[model samples]
Target: MESKEEHYSHDHIMESIRNLSENDAKTFLNLIYALLRDNTLPSEQLVSHVLSVYEKKIPRVVKTRQNK
Candidate 1:
């Protein structure tokens, strides 16, 4: 069983990942891929496929400020 500290650390790490910029997240994901490349991890492939599908489905939003 995970202790309170372990759970908190896991949640904190997940939140940090969620808050990362798009490019930063991609870099992080690639690092994870490299780490899991030794064994054929189904999860790695699943996440990559899911992200690719969503990327194709969702259009990117450009944030621009209007001139005052």
Candidate 2:
């Protein structure tokens, strides 16, 4: 079961998309679905985590592991 904060309504996501270019928004959506399919987290929770991870550590994650 997801905690209350992990869930987002369609309107909420649509609001976020409102400022995005159609091409950017489509790419964002494709990445969302990819995360949902690739990660083990629930679809709802995975979306939240994906946003969090992207906002935080995505660059570090993409950097060479050999550097660590």
Candidate of highest lDDT: 2
Model 2, 2-50: lDDT tens digits are 3434534456444444545577557666776788778987768877777
Cα lDDT for residue 31, candidate 2 = 77
User: Global lDDT for candidate 1?
Assistant: 0.44
Q: How many angstroms is residue 61 displaced in model 2 relative to the true structure, after the best TM-score fit?
A: 19
lDDT of 1 by residue, 3-31 (tens): 32232244444455455568756765675
Evaluated against the true structure, the overall lDDT of model 2 is: 0.54
For every candidate in turn, the CA RMSD to the true structure comes to: 12.3, 10.6
Clashing pairs in 1: none
Tell me the whole-model lDDT of each prediction, alpha carbons only. Answer: 0.44, 0.54
Model 1: number of backbone collisions: 0
Show where candidate 1 strays beyond 4 Å.
Answer: 1-8, 38-68
